[model samples]
Target: MENSRFWRDPAVPFIEARDVLDGRHVCYARHSHESFSIGAIVSGHSTYLNGRARHRVGQGTVVVMNPGDVHACNPLQDQPWAYRMLYLDTPWLTELQHQMGLGAHQDLRTFATTHSDDPRLFAGLNGLYATLTNADLAPLAKHSATIEFFTLAQQCLDPLPQRAVLAHDKLGRAADFIRANCTGEVTLAEICSVAQLSPSYLIRAFKQQYGLTPHGYLTDCRIQFARAQLRRGRAIAEAALDAGFADQAHLQRVFKQHLAATPGHYRAHSSIR
Candidate 1:
């Protein structure tokens, strides 16, 4: 089957959309971007990771990622994963938020959870992606679809809470260090040093706070970076080196283990459109 199709309409410059078929075996590393993204799982099942929480997402699941949120998804067992995703730039989304009566504060708007089973949101986002990518669609129709999608998204996905827990500050610091150094070798000692906690303490605390070990978190980060490189048409060997993997084979192994698809397959099938 065709691996994936990605495109951005000139009319909707702020959004990029992708449709993936047979992605249940595909895995993504922990990563983030400067845009707000939403995905609707049209078929198959996968596990979604957002922060420390994990959700089993299947058909009709709608996943949202706020800018800079560390998250990933992969298929369950050998099941086929298929979905459609839209990435909306921050400025564009901010405008939509304001139009939806969300105050002008960009920072105040955020998707609280990683995924939802909202049928309405799934339909709205799916239709919006399709409409935006249709070159023959009228501008007015695209505009209407964009508005309707954002309105539904904003209504369904809640904003981040205002309060922070003092106890988790160290964990946050550790995560930040990992993210910053994800494309390089990261060690437990280094993380502990940064967090100012002992190794055992940090390990337990980090897992408790983020639902993954430090090493697991770092792996997710590297994989995410590698995916970005591959999307840009980089070679498998180069992407592996850049993402801090031991070698191309290692990257391939990890990529398939988490994402079910090979780097070469992904690269060959992707196009800017």
Candidate 2:
């Protein structure tokens, strides 16, 4: 009991919470998770290994552990660390990605690390963790707060730049072709054929270059188009069709499942600016 300062809530279906140890015995054994971990150091200092780099944690610092990144944490000589963390599944983050209109980024492909010195975000997260641990939040409130936390985290992190087109003639041609035809239901097979590589290799190369699989990138294209159409007063039915959905229902399901809101709801609630 003395070595265990950790408290773990029942793993929420899609999220998990942990109150971690601090002080001389503070330790997180080398481990990885299938979901992203967002951690806040409440007191003392923490030294954690992430991927190939080891980082020191302090008050107000937020550490983002991407899925599958080998990480370990312990207290510095005399100082230990106490932290609260939430692990989030990829589907949840993918939904946020769609809502935020984020593009493919290498940082998103796996785990990442970021910080927030912003008083509002940092304090808000601390309060949220308290509520989560105290069982004081309703389901709806909990979901909303989680979304807010992610939005703040993304804001604090530097987004990667759009991919650069190579000067190579063939690759440039393929890239241009893909960009131009993304919304036209271009299949990965077609892209592979045009690029003169097998589908598997092409997918690898495409992801290596674009930071998303070809199909995933293409879906983003469709979602972007739908967002534009929704903003312009198009009915969900019409927007879905124009955005290449099989039907309004198809669009509605995907929109709700991936973006956490139906198209109509998103349009009504989101800022047009």
Candidate 3:
């Protein structure tokens, strides 16, 4: 795990991420993912092969591979290399295209940019990787940040940009529903129905419009609910359960993740003030 690391969260299922800190010994046979793949060379050099084309890539180079596109990267001359990559589920990305008004029919389309050295793109990809890997961030922030990054990737990497759909405020219902039921399990289906919005639309645009995903908003609601319980001198375990977390530990983890403080610390401090 020292040289290679992978990050995934069920909360954000549309994407998977991985990185290689030292790829000199790492090698891949011609391979493909059913998902859309994009990556950046963080440091070092390697030979990139896509279809019949081969190119020498170095730091700052960004590469892309569509679903089923056989490609591989290997170190050149046994030299040290490093990289970070993201694999995005095709359906999720295509639906995002539809939300962006890329086509009348929501369907996946191929992008032509095989590779580039755009500094902005390189920095964006790296930033996204960092954000996704940070465990302390809330799930809503993770998912929303993902959508924002991928949206940027599409418009900036594609040779032709699509016309963006006009903004809409239909997400309020979804937010309200989430707030109303913050202490309970809520599905994407439930939110979509309430908001009269597609999953992709809600996923990508909700944070843009409201500054938080329904899940993030729900988490905040739960935290606030727990805070109220704690103010009444209730037990932390009881507060967590009432707030819809599995148990005190679960709530403690999420509480620390969002607030960077333990429930005990918050509870003890609140009593003094």
Candidate 4:
């Protein structure tokens, strides 16, 4: 009983405490998040079916899920599967995406990945929870924990695309702009310069190609870059600059638009393992 309780709650706000479920408690109904959810399995095994494909999840393994990645979990054996997890916001992830040079897209899905040889990924989370509950740290303390967790998650992010969809011409160009200049602030005009099109023309062409205007696409790019940086151990403020946002607050505004959750929340949900 005590063991079960330990995994059930990390109790950090903006971060969903990890939960361990067994026996009849073993299934999650299909749903999506406005945030990111990172999972680490502790015991037994399970079959995670996301859409038509089924993947096995087990101990010491981590799963990175973006929002709207419809998935469900089932016990692999009568023994059942128990796990701990944190739910993060999308902008945080978007920041990571940008840092890692992954392009902007809103599709959130799940992928199985292995991150580390250290047990600290799991142990550190527990310790952070204890610290948060028992000790009084400065406001930056929670951010520090979140930063650690995201650093661990960075190792776990493997871009496993279950399916592939090619980007359109204009959208592809805008994507090029994003990757090349992710370290500095960018605007629609900058992207238009690279693509050699008028602002209005670029906006329409980009929208037709990717269903997003140049500015919208750029914003998403910035957000993903921020997430990637956080995952890479960069501070949110640093992530903001590295991802080309004007500032941390600017990053937050754009992050909230796509993820509906804050960057801080996103980092908290990203566990180290």
lDDT of each: 0.78, 0.62, 0.76, 0.59
Best-to-worst ranking by lDDT: 1, 3, 2, 4
- Cα lDDT tens digits, model 3, 1-273, are 455555666677677777778877567655445678999999999999886679999999999887645567888999998998888988898888888777647457667677889888889899988888887888799788888988888777872344333267577677678878988899999999988999998988876654456676677678768865765669999999999989999888777654334677656643110
Residue 237, model 2, lDDT: 92
Best by the lDDT measure: 1
Best of the two (1, 3) by lDDT: 1
- Please estimate how well model 2 matches the true structure, expressed as its whole-model Cα lDDT: 0.62
lDDT of 3 at 236: 99
Winner on TM-score between 2 and 3 is: 3
Residue-wise lDDT of candidate 4 within 22-94, one digit each (tens)? 6235354443344676666667777775544578767765555555344566667666667765667667656
Q: Which regions of candidate 2 fall more than 4 Å away from where they truly are?
A: 1-12, 21-23, 104-120, 161-273
TM-score of model 1 vs. true structure: 0.74
What number of backbone clashes does candidate 4 have, counting pairs of residues 3 or more apart or in separate chains? 18
Better of 1 and 2 by lDDT: 1
Q: In candidate 1, which residue pairs clash?
A: 23-81, 24-81, 25-259, 25-260, 26-259, 26-260, 27-258, 27-259, 30-220
lDDT of 1 by residue, 1-273 (tens): 567777755565677777888775356766555578889999888888887778888999999887756678877887887998887888888777666667656443776677888888888887887787776778689878887878777778866543234368888899899989999888888999999999999889877776578887788778778877886779999999999999999999888655456888766655343
Q: Evaluate candidate 3 by giving its C-alpha RMSD to the native, one decimal.
A: 15.2
